[model samples]
Target: MPAASAAHAVPPGRTRLITRPFRARRIRRALFCPQILVLGLIASAGAAPMARAQDAAVKEAPARSSVAAEIRAQVGGKLRDFYGPRGFWPVWVEKDAVGPQADALLKLIDSAEADGLKPGNYDPKGLRRAIEDADGSGDPKALARAELALSKSFAKLVADMRAPSRAVKMRYLDPEVEPRDPGPADILRAAAVTSSFEDYVEKAGWMSPFYMQLRKARADYGKTWADLPDVAVPTGLKLKPGAKGPGVGALRERLGLSPGGGYDKALAAKVKAFQGDHGLTPDGIAGPQTVTALNRGPKYYARALALNMERTRLLPGPWVRHVVVDAASARLWYYSGGKLDGTMKVVVGAKESQTPMMAGMIRYATLNPYWNVPPDLVERKIAPKILDGASLQKMNYEALSDWSANPQKLNQSSIDWQAVASGRQELRVRELPGRSNSMGRMKFMFPNDLGIYLHDTPSRDLFGKPARQFSNGCVRLEDAPRLGKWFFGKTLTTDSDTPEQHRPLPQPVPVYLTYLTAASGKDGVAFRPDVYGRD
Candidate 1:
């Protein structure tokens, strides 16, 4: 509603200019609180009725450059697709000046930083100035530019608020589901009648609680750490608790402490907290990795958290029962009733064969599973050895017609190993289940075209490393026995000469393969390395 205290300066049928004095917070509060708008004209101190003035210019809109051409130069062409269908009518301005609704939108743009979005992306300052500059000019060209800019900004904000559209890529198929976006007309019209702009943003509700948490982290970090001088500890430097030296001083200063050479309990606690947040070992020691993580500024955290927030938005959840494999963090979590039921260390895909982000339902369990060696792996490792007359039986492999467990072993002399290596002859290689089998004792199957699944590995020692990206693509569980027990309610066992067995789950469990580099949990905000360079 228009301010009740102000006089009705304009006639009932006319629109008003934006020159009316308004308290800054009041204007912002009005934008957010009221979910609906009354669409009353706002009166300026001295300007004439705005609707009467706007009507003449709007009618002349048809005689000018094509609407697309006119607006596309100011607002992007892709963004113009929404407003263009309405004959490029201005949505934010009243005649020449921006109205209170536009004021609310402009404020939102500035405050979007809370969500790690750059306000300048929507050109709020430029649009506001342009609206003021054109207010008294009575020039159609300038007013049109202002209108186009406002609409473009509004559309982009609405779309992005619903889904991080920029994060949508063919490579990250895990975020395959699209969040719903309201039609532009519906949004813009709602803004005109909304009781409060803040209410509208809350009503839009695009961000999940996870996104809000990252955003909160960004805000908290910005308040205290954004301006701190960066710490420059040399790589490989290690500082244990109570160690006194230059490294300790760097650590102290980095933790916002007044420089003291002595490392104290207080400092150790801070270091441990930082370690926990950054997915480190949290030993209260300043190692090279921990030092590097501490040295990063809020800007880095903001951007990283923002990207991860986008990644989080791509996932479907609040799941009743599901598993999440955080590829970047190399952690697997099983959730039921919105609480963590189980978690385990995981070895994900290496940089070269980066783990794919995807979603699927666990279909069944493979007992005494045969490892169908991928063609690429066969060509890379096995081909040269077998071509030199190495024993295939000693290597624990047999030639198979396809991925199915039952296959007659091909005669080694009859096979042309070189031809197989060069792909001239197609060959399917399988490794029989054994104590040293690559797929361990069992494999958890899921339906996806990527040939990805969860399995145990013989390289249990590799899980000891802090950065465990050792797999080709499939995830390797650190605690397979525990996982199997959770899945089947029994211990996993292997019988010699046993055929591969598939057993369906009592109920399917949803699985999300994600690459989030930052998120929130009971541990507060946490960050992981962007192993895939996704950020």
Candidate 2:
């Protein structure tokens, strides 16, 4: 699916993605944007049945407690939606002081670092004081205020979990997308209706394997960046085999590789592996970028762990054969049978023309594919040149009357290039497959509004860059031949001078254009630059 835009600007010489304004218009803003709704009305969720107690007046038998009334006025709607009113009166309070429900909430709030939050932020002190003051006193006003605070805290915590992510709106670029905003009401409802808080927690747990890994990173390592020693990479430091420097010694201390680990072959291998994990060029050169990677402390690493855990939740679902293109990391990963099979360097969307976030199925690919010029570029960049009697043959240009994945060629000189190039008329300008062609040799195709596909690039040198966001929006594969062979189950070539070859996959692989700037690996959790500024 192409990034469903009202109108998309196609930059020069790239495979164009068209806007699906009509399709995008069908959905409402609420489909991606989530709003908070807080409400509840029951006397005592801990006491008598909610329905039976509903008929009784506040002053009557099984009376409406102060907390219930306050919660109703405030968070009752959302609360009732979450912890269902199973004929019980008050939903939060049990035995006057902060109950078991309140206890669990407090602990979760205090240990919020794994999610990139603070205990003080969620008002842990207020809660602790309330719990401490509850000394067998059945003071309705004090208990009710405490209960109201609990309701507020619950809403805040759920909202925090949903926030900084629910607010990230790239969903317009894709509609068939990840489910976001872990519906607090639904989670609370499961918890409330369950036999115990533990069962409710199990039913409503938000942490995935990805999230757990992040928590483990925080636990196994230190909590903050300050807790870990800095792996400072001094400027102009380089350590190759037979070379020695103080920086090399610093590296050993940083990695905790051993006190005497020097610039040996073994240490060089470690450096290369470290570079790979940090999304740097694994040339084993010990370059500046490698230093940056080494110096990334626990604080940033933990944030990466937590932030990407949220990003992982955005994925719609997992697949048996999955192809994940992580734009933030500028890497493409192929997973077969739910395990990583191969990885390749990639160039994602540029800062201005960002590669989109979409999930789709890779149906087929084309061999020696022609590069169809994006329409916006034709009007802005190519039209004037064509009008000025630019020779199509010299420019490696041809005209196409129609548009599709596979287009039919037309005589370039016969058409009125001026009209089409000037934006007065629509014409298809295509660059035939050659050395100059933008899409190098082949392309992996998927159907989407965003028209984002995995393909090979002529500018292969860009892959060597530490940060590789160089595309208009599509992902460019570094080793297309490898992926192509894997996809088609046969060998295909660019050496032949012929028309494009279309090869279908025996079994379609699910493709995900995800933005995970951090992930887990065998050594430890790895962090990457937040290229799209999603962090």
Candidate 3:
């Protein structure tokens, strides 16, 4: 009866609730309730899964950020490594790191490499031909020469990377570590005093009596001398109160002359002599400049000595020699048979117009070469002159309207010269090849884009000045003709009829123009004034 009732109570599509004992029914309800509660709790916890997924995404973001930072650091490190010591990478580095011109240089570099022009394997003629065919326009030969020079310069830089360490680490003397109050004798000892001036006189090389007396004065005053204040004479050697003698005695007392006394005076005289030799105003008074000359730091002296040694090493192992210009010193040395035969003062480029430090082989000497004014000069100086109608004819400027944008299309001939002077139209001017040309009579070409080359200047008087910076960029040599003769292996008497062509020497002479603050000599290392103030 109960089964029949349950079946009759079941609705369509509904499961029948089976009837059982009261205790069993209660147990089944309890189990079903617990299962329903468990399902409800799982449905509520489903929202937490999204939060876990978000947490995982956040963790991954940091890892990606870290990778990006690592990549940037590596790039910067490589750039510094390539550019720091050698300094040849500045142009390329600056181009790549900043400036709108970066793409142009990158393109040039790519084209150069793609054409089979490697650093050490430069084929100027082949490169020129390839560049001409590649672009189908522009001066390919000039471009090729420039690229070859850059490659060679880069190779030299690579070679220099293998140079041994010449740098010295300087340790600052700590005040606490140093003696709180050093005695006079202790101070003298610390200053590297070996013996008295008298002892030096007796044992050292032949020195004049005057020099010996100076040394004595220095030694006598060494005891009372405080810090050597450049020009201050030593102190402590009490002279006769009334003796009116040479300033040597006074200088000695000021210097704190030590026993066996001539060291200080000798040092002072040497300083004065050095000043005189270097064309400084020799005042016998040790000023900042004098002190700098006397005690150039060990690091500076060491670097100078190292570079000089390098120069000597690079000299060709033969009797054939050429002119070597030490740009930093503003001096040109003539070398022959592995010896410096003569030296002459030169007016090097100014601080702003720094002569580049580079090495190259002089390929050709152009006599009476046409001076194509650098584009910079043309844009800056000549353009203004043309606009002002500043007598371009007087200046031997040839107006080349043919190169203008609308040469044949526009009526350039109808443009009034006087009216155009009033900001009417653009103009271009070029100087023909002649004596008055900016590149006077000759130009020694190695081809570099630093706009650096040895050339003659129309303004010869500028050479006589102490500092020459009158060029747009090119290096103007005072004796261009002499240099041209030396390079071409021809006499100055050679006539104009001589064929204008490069006469290759039996062996190419490598010319290096270097900048150094100091150089080594027989006596010791000599410090040079930072003529260009590069450092």
Q: TM-score: which is higher, 1 or 2?
A: 1
Instruction: Point to the candidate with the largest lDDT.
Output: 1
**For model 1, the run of ten residues with the poorest summed lDDT:** 5-14
Candidate with better lDDT, 1 vs 3:
1
Give the per-residue lDDT digits (tens) of candidate 1, residues 173-226: 222232345455544543433334434443232334455566666666566556
lDDT of 2: 0.59
> What TM-score does each of the candidates earn?
0.56, 0.49, 0.43
Ranking by TM-score: 1, 2, 3
Better of 2 and 3 by lDDT: 2
Give the worst 10-residue stretch by lDDT in candidate 3.
6-15
lDDT tens digits, residue span 392-461, model 2? 7789888777887666777766777767766788878888887767888888887777667898888878
Residue 345, model 3: lDDT of: 52
Cα deviation at 393, candidate 1, in Å, is 2.0
- Return the TM-score for candidate 1, rounded to 2 decimals: 0.56
Instruction: Give a tens-digit lDDT track for model 3, residues 1-535.
Output: 1211111110000011122222111111111123332343344336667555345335433432332233233333223343233221212111011111222322333333222234234333443343333234223233333323333332332223212222321111212111122222222121112212112212211111212232332233233222443443323332222323443443444333332343354646644554564345555555556444434433443344444433332222112244455566555555433234555554556666766655555556666565655444565676567556566657766555555444342233444554444445454445766667877776666555564567776776765766554455456676766665555556543356342334444434444455655443333334456666644
For residue 300, model 3's alpha carbon misses the true position, in angstroms, by 4.9
- Error in Å for residue 229 of model 2: 15
